[model samples]
Target: MDISEIAITAAMASGFIAIHLMVRRLNFLDATPRSGWLSFAGGVAVSYVFLHVLPDIALHQREFADGMGVGAKEAESIIYSLTLAGLAVFYGLERAVKMSRGESRKAGEGDKMGNRVLYLHLVTYGTLNALIGYLLLHREDAGAWSLGLYFVALGLHFFTADFGMRQDHPEAYDRLGRWVISAAVLGGWVLGLVVDLSPVLVGCLFAFLAGGIILNVLKEELPEERQSYFMPFVVGVLLYAGLILAERHWV
Candidate 1:
């Protein structure tokens, strides 16, 4: 990595440390906050789409056309075709693997390790998805769709680490997960520089999903038993959309 990469890594590290220091109320946290997790997941998915993929796609629009030099219609079809081709094949392989595994019987009772393995498996697939998006940014002229997928990838990062920390550091929110996530801050920024990608979307996504704390003001919230679970999702989309819109238009 060059000096820029080093600087980015350092910046990310500082950010990670700062963020970890803020999960102060985890002692009162519950891992089964499904609404919060779902909201988190959606926000993360958006993050991946916008951050890594968008800029790459913008760059690509000016680059190579499909192997055949064709008109605008042909270009779009080719782009969508190529995009769906990879995702389709991947989805198919994934289904096949899941089917095979589903058919296999477990020899022993599942334990924490089994659960963690499942999480790791899902996270690993997500990481690969991001990497593939990164590679597409390099090789293909993927446009808006690539942008969308990139945000999805960055979102996956937020989802995994945040969700993992929920489970891993239940009583103690500052464990190795803290260190790991902290490392990812600078690490991600550094990698962005190394890959020659902009860090704007990724960093903001990180700031948003892993960004702040939720203060459920009893006076501000609906009745405890009557609280609508949809609040988190609404908050999530609104936050992201607002951010995107503002950055594009308002700002």
Candidate 2:
């Protein structure tokens, strides 16, 4: 990688890791700031999907269809299919994790099945972080300012993730979650440096991540236990959305 690429990767990886550690101290997830920062993060992530990521998906899918001489409708269907698959997979994963957590509370070690469930959740979480890290590098080539904004939104989203994981499995998350998942971001950047994904594959990654972001952010925000603030959510939506909009128009 060139100097610019390396710098972007380092900054984003450090930022992602820093946020996870910061949340443990700041308690942004469970505290009053949850309404402001957490809600804003959730809104920013959602707006990123609707405003920027989804449109890119549509554009890429169209380009893929044209390049392959396929029907536009078929291409659209295929893209949506992958998107739904991504959503369903994460949804199922979260449900299984919740069930395992409940069982763990009930039957001691919750048996081997419960252990496996937590393992799967952490593995998936780490893998997703890596994917996002890789995509961050890809986005940097577009513009530094755009990448900076992306980092802000993603860093905040990861903050909420750290909080949720720590809340769900305090001991396990503290001992393993922070280090492992933080490393995953760096690992993903290295993998991205070596492996050059095709445009279609990159689009698939974006689609999968878009689904994951939507699911994870909403899971944190919509719960009555969260006590999220309306204005912060609105502020986040408008603030991040306006940044993305400005980039779309000017950059």
Which of the numbered candidates is closest to the native, going by highest TM-score?
A: 2
> How accurate locally is residue 88 in candidate 1, as Cα lDDT from 0 to 100?
53
Index of the highest-lDDT prediction: 2
Worst 10 residues of 1 by lDDT: 211-220
How do the predictions measure up, each by TM-score?
0.46, 0.91
Residue 105's C-alpha lDDT in candidate 2? 64
Per-residue lDDT over 1-251 for candidate 2, one digit per residue giving the tens place of the 0 to 100 score: 58877876787788888876667777434775354777877888888878888888786777768755788888777777777777788789878978887787687864223668778888989989999888877751267776777788788888777777777777777777788898898888888788877777777777888788888888888888788888888888898889988888898
Model 2 residue 164 CA deviation (Å) reads 1.0
Question: What C-alpha lDDT values do all the predictions have?
Answer: 0.40, 0.78
TM-score of structure candidate 1: 0.46
Candidate 1 structure quality by residue, lDDT tens digits, 1-251: 34643453344345434645555444433433444644544554444344433444444442324334565465445444544454554344334434434443353432122334344534433344333323323323233443333344344344434544444233333444444444444444445445754343332222222212111111112335423356665565566655555444443
